[model samples]
Target: MFALMQSTRTQSLHLTVDAATGLKAVIAIHSDRVGPALGGCRYLAYPDDESAMIDAIRLAQGMSYKAALAGLPLGGGKAVIIRNPHVENRAALFEAFGRFIESLEGRYITAIDSGTSTVDMDCIALSTQHVTSTTAAGDPSPHTAMGVFAGIRATSMARLGSDNLEGLRVAVQGLGNVGYALAEQLHAAGAELLVSDYDSGRVQLAMEQFGAHPVASEALISTPCDIFAPCGLGSILNCQSVNQLRCAAVAGSANNQLTNLQAADQLEARGILYAPDYIINSGGLIYVALKHRGEDLGTITAHLARIPLRLTEVFAHAQAEKRSPARVAESLAERLVYQKGV
Candidate 1:
């Protein structure tokens, strides 16, 4: 479809199962230039088939860069189940997906993502051994949070020229595992937290745990904060939200935070330091890659620590070249990909 083409440069494959009334799956293998594709399986209720397809393809492409930027051996791929997981016949449908993945012959790898959890990945592991999970060793959410924390610190140092987070107001727009952990890290660093989530339970928990002030999800964009961390979903930073942001820096774990490439430029024009989503959020991919290679934990920690250094380079390149941060980050990734080819 044209929409899918516009969203990503990956090959799209569809899988269906008859056991359920109607089950559909889309897998976007963005690139295998570095290696076989590796990414997460996210389940969501898409607006339509076309939207689902576009999201899958774009997410897959982002995964490729996320892996490459983190120096992972794997390429990028993403899978999306096009139905609500809470509906009827969820487990059977996921198992069916496992078989579909098995048929790929190791060309694509599946892990956990937004809608999918480590437990769901475990379910998929039932039918195929190709599956990789963050929880097989331990929870990856905290590790991801730690990486974002480091990235936020690095971005703050580069943009606002500050390292101490004490009393810095940060608006965390998601309360999922990663967001909650992020909130904890910001709190531990003495940052003042203003949090929001569609899930009342998550918001309540955050308020009780960290003394966070709760705000409506949509209103979070205009909140007064030194930093705005979007850990919820992609495309939250768009034309509309850019003008509303009061934060000095934007950094979070969500991939493809910009709805489109132009949104990155818009952020730069607005005087808000925008950290490329893929560059800042590659920590989860880094952790998974290290685990996949059977590497040591110390190595993983050390690699993650290098995120700040890498981001510092990106920030410097953006400033020296007077180019959008996203463009500079993409150039770095393309350079790596080219070097690999040579």
Candidate 2:
């Protein structure tokens, strides 16, 4: 665990267990160079404690990069609550988790992430003010999807010589809030949609709503399309999966999409344009950060408009350097978070 932190340059890890509420959580602070670390809190079951710790550390690092490249005056951190199926009271567990967040003072701010919701953030807020995405702060999923939609247009313009999605085949993997919303936008743009998800209901809904053709989850990566959008979990693009992709470009709202840095090289080797996940999917972070600062909806929307510009900059740099956009984005984010190149 210490080795992992050292390799990632993570600043600290905090662990707390509340036997009464059956709360076991890990908060990893990756960096605070620019300002207080801010990220979403994820609550999910894990195979083991080590897995949970690793998730927190990796996610926190991604948040740091996400905030830095988005030009936000903040650093990165993340909290993961190991789900307890036997726990009787969810609110009590989250409230206890909130108190734990409060104990950190102002070093970390929490928001909604996968397996967590605005209601959970509201509960956390009851205990600590260091929470966003509450019932009042609003859900960040739509903004995240909006940003990703713009990014896909920019990516298409970069790789296909046009941003028009009309008649383009787009394979959308995952039917979560963000993925579904993105599909809606793509469908509105007249893109022919190929959809897949573990949930049969979401797939059926997509088919009915967007005239989407359903693809098996296992085969979606290999399905030919103009663009592949992965709005699900992380580590989807690894050695084996990257070899199976049949798309011209990959873009979506999933963080840490590449299992390892080498996957980016593999995509470039295959002529698949890759939009760094953290850079393309940063709309949620931008929304929550600005909203937390009391910015209105108009200001937040304007900030989201910059997602494509940043992605275009990364693409240009990658082309000039003859490297993958993932590598270039990491270098750029590192310079900002660590102040390495000013």
Candidate 3:
């Protein structure tokens, strides 16, 4: 697995296998200079182990950037279990996976993401106390949507000259847990929603509940709207799709949305404002990280309130310098990483 990350300077990449449970897991730690590593457990079928290793590395790196920007004393790490939970001995597998985390001795902590859930966290908790986003905190999806809402409003303020989402046409791609919550919030704010998802059931629900118009998945980026919210996978916004985006801004819960720094440049040159993915999507990580610190609900709420403020700062700086907000956010996060890690 480490061979997959060949030239990249990864801190650690640990894989565990249990033949009895058919468990093949990979844990990647990107950095711990700022604090202990905290991320999520992802359970999904990969084309191969190399793909899973690459996914873990990218997610862990994103978590580090996300943690720094969110002002959390945490580094970046991620664990990926490559298995079809539907067919495997799930309970025994999750328990064994939890022991892997336990063996890390708190150097790496995890919550939930993608195919993993709170019940999986409970199973992991049986072996280690390093799991979070469970119990009182519940799912972090809503908080993540809230933070993205803050970012979208910030983008509107900077680019559209208004922060009010009322009547704003926003196209949200992907209708997963976080995407549904975001679509709901956008509707509540009176924004006309254009929603798309691979799951047709979710699309029908969004249309019925939020009055969202449906767009085909492939046509999402070209839809005319005030904002384009990519709430699904990462690396979708590349040089090609960047120009295809018809919105005035981009903000969503998807991590690593940009294909590279050049994607940011493409958006900027096209006069589109982009709220950095890591900065906007850090809300989930923030919730879990705060929960790990045993913070109360009120404290977590207060801390989350900073998400918008940070975005506003990034927006203002971007406008002042006429630079991509992505670059500005990256510099800010790196400063935090270096400072806090010190």
Candidate 4:
């Protein structure tokens, strides 16, 4: 564990054990180079503790990059609670987890993440004043979707020479909150959607509400389309999927989209544009971070509007340097962070 943390340059890794509630949680704080570390609390049933620790490290590092690219006065951190999805006593467990957060003081602030919700944020707020998503901002999914929508336009504009999404075909590989909302936003922009999800109910809702065409979940990524939006889990762009992908570009809300840096190279070699997931999907983080700081909604909205502009800059830099957008984004973020004192 020590070697793993050292190799990743992780700042801190915390473990919480609550025997009574069967809560086994890990909090990974990657950086506070910019400001207090802020991220989301994820509740997942990992196969083992090693997997959980690795997840925390990867997620925390991703948050650091996401925060840097978004221009927020914050760094990155993440907490994971390992438990069954259908755990019987959620309140007690979360409350205990909240106390653990309190122990960190203001070093880390958490919000709703995968397998968690605004209601869970409320429960977490019970023990620490360090939780967000409990205010009027509510769910950050819509904001994330909005940013992705803007990112797709910018990517399309650069690659295809027009930002208009009208009549464009989009294959959405997930119909979760962010994915469904993104599909709706695209439909409103006059784009055709090929939507899929493991849950038939979500797929039906997307089709009924947005006129999306349903595709089988497993096959959506390989479907031919103008854009492939992966709004679900991470590591989807591995060696196998990269060979199968058939799209002009990929821009979505999922974190850690690349299996590793090599996946970015593979996509670039295929002439596929990739809007770095950390940059494009940072709207939700910006919303929550501003809310945590008690910044006005107008400021948050304005900040969210800059996502596409920054992405455009990233695209421009990538084109000029003849590098992958992911690499360009990381370089841009590193420069910013270092300029502010790495």
Candidate 5:
């Protein structure tokens, strides 16, 4: 299984910096099923070279599934810029990234991801027209959250037999862009919210903007809520944290939620409804795919509305066959891609 998983890490196009600073940039294009691969370029200070490579490879692989499940005519690709943006040569780094994208010549389209933002994407757009900057309309976080909000409703209906979130208590871990947007939707639905973040400022914003109940970072998972939303980072829903969760369902935007397939099975045995990350957090991919193809927002919104239906199907399959939701989601995505000969 490890070998198969690692096989997903295709060789990336690498470019090394020639500055006094040693920086590495990688563009990993996982697949091109529906169309050309599309993903965000992230700039961060990885602890080591291997870590950055693994993140780029894994994220790109996830994008392939994300676009496939979202029914988009695009594949998956990701770019990673080595060096902590806070301390790096911003102009040189971004220019190098832009030149790198230019080198691809439309094979791989770059956008914003975890560490990359609209402002940063603007820098990328300067040197390469291949960069996508839908950020002008505003952050995609709220739209993503809206999609997740819709998904929760769909999941609740299919799994918990609830159609409304009027009285639902949701614990959102990581009050970032998508997290804050999700909080807004929950508040609008009259759902009580508990939010947490590594940044105190974001936590305070969640509290001030939505009147959220803030919790310590360590307590976010076991807050005894209807939904445990891990919006911050990946691998939080592993074996240890799964045992600590007090929520009825696990759903959020973070990628690679399960550390491994065994943890996904563990969540199933515990009867905790697990919405696969690749399936539920597909809104961003959908938006980018549309922008890449020059499609309008109405078309994008219509496509986004199908997420809940997809979730319903995945949940039913999991329950009926006694399989993990992640596996079911992956199987369905692979079947679609395989049928298309992609």
Candidate 6:
């Protein structure tokens, strides 16, 4: 564990267990150089404690890169609450988790992520002030979708020589809050949509509402399209999956899309313009960070407008260096967060 921390340059790792509430959580603080660690809390079942710790560590590191690349005055951390399927009281469980957060004081501020909701945030707020995405704070999904939409346009401009989405085919691989919202925007822009999800209801809804063609989840990666948006889980793009892709570009709101750094090189070799996940999917973090600092909606929107410009810069640098955008983004983020070139 210490070796992992040293390798990733993570600052610290914390854990807490409340037997009564069945709360078992791990928090990984990747860095606090720029500011306090800010990230989301994920509540999902894991195979083991080691898996949970690794997830938290990788996600915490991504959050740090996300914040640094977005030019936010915040560091990165992440929390994973190993789900207790048999727990009777959900609120009590989250509240106990909140107390664990409070114990860290202000070092970590958590919001909503996968398997978590605003209600959970409210419950967490009951014990600690270091929480966001409460009902009052509003959902960050739309903002995240908005940023991704802009990023897709920017990516289109870089790869296709045009920012227009009309008449283009886009395969979206998730139907969660962010993915569904992005599909709505893409439909509004007259983009042809091919959508897949584990939930039949969400896929049916997309078909009925957005005229999206339904594709099997397993086959979506191989589906030919102008853009492949992975708005779901991480590590979707691995060695075999990369070879299966038939898209011109990859962009979405997923965190850590590449299974490893070498995956970026593979995408580049295959002539796929890869939008680094952390850089393109930072809309929610921006919304949460600015809102926490009391910024208005106008201010937040203005900040979001920078996503495309930053991505354009990354693309230009990648083109100049003859490297993948993922590598360029990682190098740039490391320089900012670590205060030295990697």
Off by over 4 Å in 2: 340-342
Candidate ranking (TM-score, best to worst): 6, 2, 4, 3, 1, 5
Cα error, residue 287 of model 1, in Å, equals 1.4
Which portions of model 1 show Cα errors greater than 4 Å? 2-7, 338-342
Q: lDDT scores for all predictions?
A: 0.83, 0.93, 0.87, 0.88, 0.80, 0.94
Give the clash total for candidate 2. 0
Shift of residue 13 alpha carbon in model 5, Å: 5.0
Backbone steric clashes in candidate 3, count: 0
TM-score of each: 0.94, 0.98, 0.95, 0.97, 0.93, 0.98
Tell me how far the alpha carbon of residue 190 in candidate 4 is from the true structure, in angstroms, after superposition. Answer: 0.7
Tens digit per residue, CA lDDT, model 5, 211-323: 88999999888879888888887889778989998877888888888888889988888888889888888887777667666789999899899988899989989889989
Runs of candidate 5 exceeding 4 Å displacement:
1-6, 9-15, 18-23, 85-88, 134-138
Q: Please list the residue runs of candidate 3 whose C-alpha ends up more than 4 Å from where it truly belongs after superposition.
A: 1-9
Candidate 4: which stretches are off by over 4 Å? 135-137
The alpha-carbon lDDT assigned to residue 102 of candidate 1 equals: 90
Show the lowest summed lDDT stretch of 10 residues, model 3. Answer: 1-10
TM-score of 3: 0.95
The 10 consecutive residues of candidate 4 with the worst lDDT sum are: 333-342
Residue-level lDDT of model 4, residues 295-325, one tens digit each, is 8979989999999999999999988998899
Query: Would you list the rank order by lDDT, best first?
Result: 6, 2, 4, 3, 1, 5
lDDT by residue (58-99, candidate 1, tens digit) is 888788777878877778888988875456766667777888
* lDDT tens per residue, model 3, 1-342: 555455444688998998777889999998876578998888989998888989999888788888888878788999999976365567788888989999998889988898888888888888888888765558998889988888888878888989999999999999998999999989999999999999999999999999999999999999899899999988889999987888888988887788789999889999998998888887888888887788888998898889888889998998899889999988887677766652
